[model samples]
Target chain A: MTLVLFVQHLANGLITGGLYALVAIGLSLIYGVLRIINFAHGEIFAVGAYVGFFLWRVLGVPLPLAFVGAMVGTAAMGVAAERLVFRPLRFADPLNSMISAIGLSFLLQNLILQVGGAEPRRLDPFMSGVLLVGPIALPLQYLFILGLAGVLIAAIEVYLRRAWNGLALRASSQDLGTAALMGVSIDRLARVTFAAASALAAAAGVLVGSVFLLQPTMGVSMAAKCFVVVILGGVGNLPGAIVGGLVLGVAESLAVAYVSTALRDVVAFVVLIVALLFRPQGLLRGA
Target chain B: MLALDRVTAVYTGRAVLHEVSLRVAPGEIVAMIGANGSGKSTTLKVITGGLRPVGGQVLLDGEPLEALAPEAVVGRGIALVPEGRRVFPRLTVVENLRIGAYSRADRNRYREDAARVFELFPVLAQRARQEAGTLSGGEQQMLAIGRALMARPRWLLLDEPSLGLAPKVIDVVWDAIQKINADGLAVLLVEQKAFAALQLAARAYVLENGRIVAEGPSATLAADPRVKQAYLSF
Candidate 1:
C-alpha cells in the first residue's frame, strides 16, 4: 500500500480506537474502583444506542439531546444494575460478581432484543460528508467521535485530579477500607462511578449508531473488543486502556488494509493474547 | 468517648477478635498492643467499621457506632490511618490530603486543615505535587496521618504508624503523635512496638489471641510482670 493509504488507515484506526477507549475506559474505571469486571458493560453501550435511537428517530428530539438522554438513561440503568445486582454481592466472592455480570449481560442483551426486535437499526447523522485534508479524506462523524472521546477522557482525568468526588473515587480504588474510614462513602462512590462510566459507554453507543448497524448484540463484539483494550492497557489502569484501545484500533485498521476485513475483528484477540503472554501487567503500569 | 464492649470480629467464621473490649476517653491517647495476628489490627477494624462485629457493640459518645457503615463511622467523627500508610499510590500528596477531608462538612476549612497538616510536616508541603507512592516511608506515614487529620475527626485511629521506619523517622512520627494528642485529638493507637506505645498512651490494653488480656494505666502496664514478659520484653 502507498504511504498515503497507510496514513489514511492509521487515522481511521485511531478514530475507531477513540470509540474503543470510551468503552474500555468505563470498564477500567469500574474495575479500578469497584474491582469488578462489569460483564454487562457492553449491554450498557447497546442500551445507550437504543436510547439515542428512540429519542432522535422516534421521539423527534434533537441529536444532541438524544445523546444526553442516552447517557442519563444508561447511567440510571447502571446504578440500578449496581444496586440490584452487584451491591448485593459486595461481600460475595469476586468470582460471583463476574458471574453475575455475565448473567446480567445476557439478560440485558435478550431484554433489548425483546424490546427493540432483532432488526439492525441505523442512525442518520445530523451532519455528514468528509473533510479532504491534502490526500486523506476524513469523515466528519469519525472526527466527532475522536474529538468527543478525547474530551470525555480528558475530562475524567481532570475530575480525578481536581474534583473532590473524583479524588475520593481514586482513593477508593486504591484502598476501599481506608477510603471508607476517611469518609468516602463506598455506596455513593460505587453508584457515582458506575453512572459516570456508563454514561461514557452510552456516548460511545450514540456515536456507534451514527456509523454502524445497531443490533441487540452490538455490545458483544464491542464489549469483547473493549475487554481486549482493557487487558492490553492493563486492568484498572486508565492510561493503559486509552493506549490499548488506540493500538488495537490501528492494528485492526492495518490488518484490514493489508490482509482482509475478515481479519479486522480478530486483531483485538491477537493483541489480547500477546499482551497477556508478554506483559500481562499491561503496556502502562500505573494509572 | 469510644467504647467497645465485648466486640467479636469473625474472619471466615473464625473469630479474630473474641469479645475484645476497650475504651478511649476524649482527648486521650489509648494504645492496643499485641503480637502479629493477635487482633490488634482487627480491634481497630472493629472501631473503624472495616470489619463488622459478629457480637457486642461499639459506642461513640453513647451512640451505636457498629450499626453504621464505615463512611458513616467517619462522619460520626473517627478516622483511621490504616496500616501500610494506604495513601493512594498514584495521586499527588495534596490530592491525598484533600481526599482525607472527603468526610468533612466544611469544605472551606479544607485549606485551613491542609495548612495545619503542612505545618506539622513541612515535607508534605514540599511534596504536595508529588505522587504519594514516591514519598519516603516516613513521609507517607505523615501523609497518612495528615490525610486522617483532614477529616477533622473527633478520634484518630492509627495502626502501626512505625511499621517500617528508621529510628529517626519513628522519632518524628512519635513527636507528631504527641503533638496531635496535645492538640486535643483523641488517639487510638494500635502498635506492635509495645514499649513506645505504652510511653505515649495514657491507658493501654494488651491483646492476646483476640482478647484483652491486660488493661491498666500506661505506667502500670509497663510495670506489670506478665505484660513485660509478653509484650515489653524488647
Candidate 2:
C-alpha cells in the first residue's frame, strides 16, 4: 500500500511539474524577447484549457486533435492581443501596460465564467491505464506530458539557435530601437513571441486539464505557480525553468509522502521562498 | 538620393523641426551640424521614419516617405545608425548583423551583405559570437554601423558617430564612414564634432533651435562667420 501510494503521488507530481515547466518556459521566452512579464499569460493558458475542453465535449474530437486546436486557437488569441492591446500600449508607461494586462486577465477569466459557468469542469480521462515496472507503477499520461514538454523545449532551443526569425527575435530583445535600425521589425517579432508563448501556455493548460480538475478561476493558481517557477529558474532563462520545475515537483512529492497531503501547496511556496532567499535572482541565474 | 522637402516635425505638440529641408545625392556625404537640442537628431529621426513629419514630405528617389513605416523605410534602402550606438546588448555581434537584413528577402544576398560588413569591419568578424553589450564602446559602435550596412541601404543616416570615442578610434570610425559613402551609399551625417564632419562631408547644413540656420558646400559653411562663431569652438 505504501509503495503504491508513493508511486501514485510521484506520478501526479511529475505530470503537474511537466505542465508547470511548459507554462514557465513560455513565460520566460516572452520575457527574454519582449522584456515584459506578460501578466495575462496564465489567463491565456486558462483560455486554452477551456477551448480544448469545449472541443472535446462538443465536437467529440480526440485529445491530440483538441490539443492542436487549443494551441493554434490560443496562439491566435495571443497574436490578436498583441495587435489590439499591447501594440497600442507599446510606448505607454510599463506600469500602465502591466495594469492593462491585469485588466485583460480579469476580463478573460470572467468571460470564461460567463460562457462556461461557475460549475467545475473536468474532462474524462483521455488516456488511462498504468505500466507496472516491478514494484513501481507509472501512468502513461505522465510520460506523454513529459515527452511533449521535452519536444517543445527542444524545438524552441533549435529555433533560437539557428532559425532566421529566431535570430531576429534574439536581436530585438536585446535592444528594440537598435533592432529596428537593423531593419528588424521589433513590433512584428514581439507579436510572434507573444503568440508563441501564449500557445505554449495554452497547450500545457490543455494537457493539465486531462490530469486535474478545471475551472475558470484555475488560471490564478497556475499563473502564480508559473511565476514562481520562472523566478526560481531565473527570468529569461530557458533551461532553468525545466530544472526548477523538476526540483519543485520532487520536493512536493517528498513533502506529500513524508509530511502531510494537505501541506503540498505549502511545500511548493516554501520551496520558492527558500530558493529566493539563497539566490535572489534564481538558482540558475549566472549572477 | 534622399531628400527632405520642407519637412516639419513635432514632439508632444511642440515643433522640433520647422520646415527643415536637406538632401543627400547618390554617393554624396552630407553633414548636419548643431549643438545639443538643435534638432540634428530630430532630422535624422524624420528621415529614418522613426518620427513622422507633420508638414511637407521626406522623399527617397522622389517618392513621399510619409506613407511608409520605419521598417518600410529600411526596405526602401535607408538605414539609420542611431545615436548612442544602441546595439542590442544581449545579442551576439553576428546576430546584430543578421537583423540588419530583416527587411531583405533574399537569404543569399543577406549572406553576401554580411560578408561585406565583415570585410569592412574585421573586428566584428573576430567577435562574431561575443555579445554586443560586452564589447568596448568603440567595438559596439562598429557593430552598430556594421548592422546598418547589413541592410545594404542606398542611403545611410549616421547620427553622431564620434560622440564618445578616443581620437584614434574616431579616425577609424570616420574612415569606415567615408569608405561606406565611397562605395556608392549616400550618407546624411549628423554631428556635434563640427570639424571632423566638415572635413568629411561635401555639403553641410547647420541647424539651430529646431530650424536650419545655414546650408552650403562644406567649405563655404565652415568659412561662414555664424558657423565659426556658434559651432567651431576654436
Candidate 3:
C-alpha cells in the first residue's frame, strides 16, 4: 500500500477504535463496580439504533435530536434493566448474574427482531462532505465520530475525576462495603453507571448505524469485538479499554489493508488470545 | 449514641454473633476485645448495616435502624473503618478522604473536614496527592481512620485498627484514636490487641465464641483474671 493509503487506513482504524472504546468503556465500568459482565450490552446498542431510526424516520425529528433521543432512551432502558434484572441478582454468585445477563441479551435480541423484522436498516448521516489533507481523503462522518468520541470520553474522565457522584462510583468500584460506610449509595451508583454505560453504547450505535447498517444480530459481533477490547485493555481499567480498542481497531485495519479483507474479523480474537497469554492482568493492571 | 441490642448475625446460615448486645453513649469510647473468629468484626458489621442481624435490634439515638442499608447508617452519622485498612488503593489520599464525605448534604464542609483529617494525620497530608496503596501499613491505617472521620460521623466503628502494624506505629495510631475520642466523637473499637484497646477505651466487652463473656470498665477488665489469661499476654 502507498503511504497515503496506509495513513488513510490508520485514520479509519483510529476512528473505529474510538467507537469500540466507547462501547467497551461502558462494559468495563459496569463490570468494575457491579462485577457482572453485561451480556446484553450490545443489544442495548441495537436498541439505541432503532430508537434513532424511529425518531428520525417516523417522528421526522432531525438527526442530531434523534441521536440525543436514542442515547436518552437507551439510558432509560439501562436503568430499568439494572432495577428489574441486575439489582435482584446483586448478591448471587457472579456466574448467576452473568448467566442472567446472557438470558437478557437473548430476550432483547429476539424482541427487537420480532418488532423491527430481520431486515437491516440504515440511519441518515448527521452531516455530509469530506476533507482532503494532501494525499489523504478523510470522510466528514468519520471525523465527526472521532471528535464526538473524544469529547465524550474526555467528559467522562473529567466527571470521574471531579464530580461527586463520579467519585462515589469510583469509590464503590474499589470497595463497596467501605464506600457504603462512607455514605456512597451502592444502589444509586449502580443506576448511574448503567445509565452512563448505556448512553455511550447508544452513541456508538447511532454513529455506526449512520455509517454502516443496523440489524438485530449487529450487537452480537459488536459485543464480541468490545469484549475483546475490554479483555485486551484490562477487565476493570477504563484507560485500558480505550487503548485496547484502538489497538484492536488498528490491528484489524492494518490486516485488511496490508493482507486480506477476509482476515479483518479474525484480528480481534487473535489479539485477545495473545494478550491473555502474555498479560492475563490485561494491558493495564486493574482490580 | 449507637446500640446493638441482643443482635444475632449469621454468615451462610451459621451464626457469627449470637445475642450480642453493646452500646456506646455520646462521645464514649467502647472497646470490644476478642480472639480471632470470635465475632468482634461481626458485631461491627451489624452496627454498620453490613450484615443484617437475624435477631434483635440496632438503634441509633434510640431510633431503630431496621433494614437500613450501610449508606443510610452513615447518613445517621456512623462510619466503619473496616479491617485491613481497605482504602481505595488506586485513589489519591485526598480522593479517598473526599469519598468519605460522599453522603454529606453540605458539600462546603468537605474542605474543612479534610483539613481536620490532615491535621490529625500530618503524614496523610504529606502524601495527599499520592495513591493510597503506596502508603505503608501504618499510614494506610491512618488513612482508613481519616477517611471515616471525613464522614463527620457521630460514632466511628473501627475494626482492628492496629492489625499488622509495628509496635511503634501502633502507638501512633492509638494516640490518634484517643485524640479523636477527646474531640467528643464516640468510638466502637474492635480489636484482637486486647491490652492496648483496653488501655485506650473507657468501657470494654470481651467476646468468645460469638457470646459476650465479660463486660465492665477497662481498668476492671484489665485486672480480671480471665481477661488477662486469654488476652493480655505481653
Best by TM-score: 3
Once superposed on the true structure, which residue ranges of model 3 sit more than 4 Å away at CA?
A: none
lDDT of 1 by residue, A35-126 (tens): 99899999999999999999998889999899999999999999999999999999889999999999999999999899889999988874
lDDT per residue as tens, model 2, A4-28:
7787777767777878888888888
For candidate 3, write residues A33-86 as lDDT tens digits: 888899999999888888888899889999999999999999999999999999
lDDT, model 2: 0.84
> Ranking by TM-score, best first?
3, 1, 2
Per-residue error for A35 in candidate 2, Å, reads: 5.4
B52-142, model 3: which lDDT tens digit per residue? 9889999888899958987888888888899999999989999999988888888647889999999989999999999999999999999
iRMSD for every model: 1.0, 1.6, 0.9
Docking class of 2: medium
Backbone clashes under 3 angstroms, per model: 1, 0, 0
Candidate 3 residue pairs in clash (backbone atoms < 3 Å):
none
Question: How much DockQ does model 1 earn?
Answer: 0.81
TM-scores, all models, native as reference: 0.94, 0.90, 0.96
> lDDT score, residue A127, model 1?
62
lDDT of model 2, residue A223: 81
Q: Model 1, which residues run further than 4 Å from truth? A: B6-21
TM-score of chain B of 2: 0.97
Candidate 1 docks at the CAPRI level of high
Which stretch of 10 consecutive residues in model 2 chain A shows the poorest summed lDDT? A173-182
Candidate 2, RMSD to the unseen true structure: 3.0
